[model samples]
Target chain A: MDATQLIHPLLALALAPLMAGIVNKTKSAFAGRNGPPVLQPYRDLWRLLHKGAVYSRTTSWILRAGPIVSLAAVVTALAMLPFGGTAAPLSFAGDLIVFAYLFGLVRFLMVAAALDTGSSFEGMGASREVTFSALAEPALLLALAALARMAGSPSLSGLLAGAVANPAVSIPVLLLAAAAVGIVLLAENARIPVDDPNTHLELTMIHEVMILDTSGPDLAFAGYAALLKQWAFAALLVGVLVPWRTGVLWADVALALAAMAAVAVGIGVVESTMARLRLVRVPQLLLAAVACAALAVVLVLR
Target chain B: MDFWVNCLVVLIAMTNLRLLGSSRVVSCVHTVAFQGVLLGVLAIVGASGGLAAHGIVLAAVNIVLKGLVFPWLLMRALRETHLRREVEPAIGFGASMLLGVLLIGICLWIGSRLPLPVGVQASPLLVPAALFTLMVGLFMIVARRKALTQVVGYLSIENGITAFGLGFALKEALLVELGILLDAFMAVFVMGIIIFHISREFDHIDAGELSALKD
Candidate 1:
């Protein structure tokens, strides 16, 4: 196994919670509020680990198992995702497709667990999530497919590693794909505009409401999984943007980290500046990703 | 491995036939279960000559969940609901079967026309089997009136993909394949519970009756 391959999973696991904390701080700073420290999320996780959970009267064991499954699935996905053009700890030809579907699995569990609670609010969120993600997936796939075609390789690492070697025309397509995926990240991770994580109204929330009944270590696992997902997406975007060079190991790693931070800051800015879109409008936003991805496809094919 | 791939193809064809001919929800669940088990066997066969521990684990999970646990769960639910017979399909059984045959032809034709890339030794049967399964799944989802049947159809499609994945690229990361299987299982599990709840609340399982969402 390559040293870089080993580093990817470690970096992903270590930085995920911090990324969540950073996003919170940035959003707070943008709102002009004295934000909680960047370490707040870690503290929350630690506290939750020691606390006891309260279960819904209607839930089955699946509800309790949701966070455990979510964490496992996300970590599994991270294990397959390549960072900085290096191979993931686990990779195969066409692994990217699997990566997308694994995340789908996480979504499936989260939604099911939410619905298991028999809370109407959670059901509503689950319904919307499935609907939007169904549309979002093809767009995500097509975007990566375009990149794959351009790089002449089907693997995620190969496509992203080769991205920087493309001509100038490819830059626009890459940027557009990044932007599209960035929006998907926000929608998927339950950031602002797509969802307000801070919202008190369960009726208007997406991710948070689904876990209204979760507590203790389960909550910690869920929180960590969410952050891990965000980090994975950011890493993917970083792989797309940062140039790949074998000799520049330190520079590549640095650039990847910076790109990730930039994504967090971007999310914070969006959260601070914009109000959440109406529920119906969320699909429209997802459609934009489809449209942009379609453009990338046309460009690559042309 | 080739024999296993052939078995998967036959099973895919059987699933298509079941979807086209059977109105019984329980039978449809059983057919999907058979497909799932065949797929699990295919995964094991595909991994037999390889050293990927992950792939073996994935195959084991697929066998246990897709083959045994899921089917058992669906069957239990079927018994509880006592809705065994499908009354009328959107398309007649004979016509649907004919369409299924035509779909297999299309799959075969498409599979033959595509040139296999170098260093890839995918079985000729793999692609068609996948396409056939996918089409059958889509057909079941559309033709069936009951929401539970539609969910089963979706699971069948996932199984088809898994079979194809094993045949074409099982040597790649097994994590994603495992994840996909886990996701499908959980999705079906959740959908099954929801279907039960919906049936209990509405006193019917037809998608047409759940028109409360429409404006």
Candidate 2:
């Protein structure tokens, strides 16, 4: 692959934690406090990597493999995603489905690993994750499908590239699908209005509780993978909302990166502004996303 | 201009969903008021250059009546009733939102099937959005339990009708549109008075609770 293709993956690896840092900084800024350094996540990952591992007696090979597989899946998914205006390194005609299910695989592995611990809290967390993701998955797919149809291409890169090519036709479609995918990003990443990543209460936790038993390097992997997933999804959103392409590879890549950073700030604002929906009401929010995607589909179909 | 029209349409549709999902009576009123103003702006945006004066006057009347007058009347009625929130719904919020989506889909399908008018420069989304808002208002009136919410729903229906009317402004006269607006205002005024009396007399304005006297 050329340098443009290499930039996407390298950016994913290097800047994923920076997104979490930006989010934390934004949240802290909103609360009027000096937060951790912007490089704090990187430092945390470094610390975790050097620490010793502690495994529960009931844990098996599944528990050990969970973080690695989840991270691997996310990395593979990253390879399939186009960074802003750049085509991904490994895109094919049907890679969009593969890109989406790679997350499903991550979820499956995570749930299995959580179940392997045999902890009641982790089991509850796993159940919550499965229930919510099941609702959110359709929204992601339908939104992508709408874009695919509008772009007249089934592949992720082709849809994104095609959307950017036709601004006048794509803006309305983009507005609807962007909102749908934005909600999916927040829900799937355990952000506000779905599940708060920072809440201390175990009973209310969805994602964090699932990894209660994970510590040291394993916890680090999970955290890093979560950040990468956030970046990947945010990239997808930026790709839709910011359709600007300068035709120069470096300029286009820079614009896309800036747009992705703006998305992170937007997420931070949303998290700061809205409280988590009542658990029962989470389905309603997901349904709204589905409604948005469905609307986009209907709009394009007409 | 088409972009602005679509933006307004999106805002109008959002208000429909907001009304469906909102529990607070005052917030519902505010959302409806916001929707009314959006419809006014949409009318101006949707109109062709030839009808600029008609569009502006219609939009101004819309803003005054639905945005200011109706909201003022409803809020006064709400003050008399001392009802701030609608605690019960005939259908739950989540279900109402889902139903709202279904209504929108059906309306959009119908709208797409209908031919666009010969001379109108309106966005194709206008008709479907108008129909969706209309159905959502009707849905609210049916599904909400409070008398105040019903009033809000009725006002939403008026807003929807106004939006629908905008799509036909080329064929319909300015006088007919004004007459419709005045009629809507009077209906909301009458509804507000009746709601105030019901809440004052019965001490609770729950429409569902009013069915006890059917026998």
Q: Per-residue lDDT of B66-171 in model 1, one digit per residue for the tens?
A: 8789888777766666664663578766567657756766777777787766766666667777877888888888887888788887987897788667665635
Worst 10 residues of 2 chain B by lDDT: B206-215
Which ranges in model 1 have alpha carbons more than 4 Å from their true place?
Answer: A244-246, B1-215
lDDT string, candidate 2, B1-215, tens digits? 77777778877987888888877888898999999999888877788665578788999999988899989998998888887565468999878888887888899889889887687655788889988988888888898888888888888888888888887887455788899888988999898888887787778888876777655
Candidate 1 structure quality by residue, lDDT tens digits, A1-302: 88778888898888888888788888878777878888888888889999988886778999988999999999988998777656688877898898899899999999999989888898998987888788779778988887888888888867777555544446656765776687778888888878888998988888898888788889999999998998988887777766555557676677678888888888888888888887866765676566556545644664
Task: Report the error of model 2 at residue B137, Å.
Answer: 1.1
Model 2 TM-score, 2 decimals: 0.95
Best by DockQ: 2
CAPRI verdict (incorrect, acceptable, medium, high) for model 2: medium
Which 10-residue window of candidate 1 chain A scores lowest in summed lDDT?
A162-171
Best by lDDT: 2
lDDT of 2 at A134: 93
Give the per-residue lDDT of model 2 (tens digit) for A98-192: 98999999999999999999999889999999999998998999999999999888898888883555444467779989999999999999999
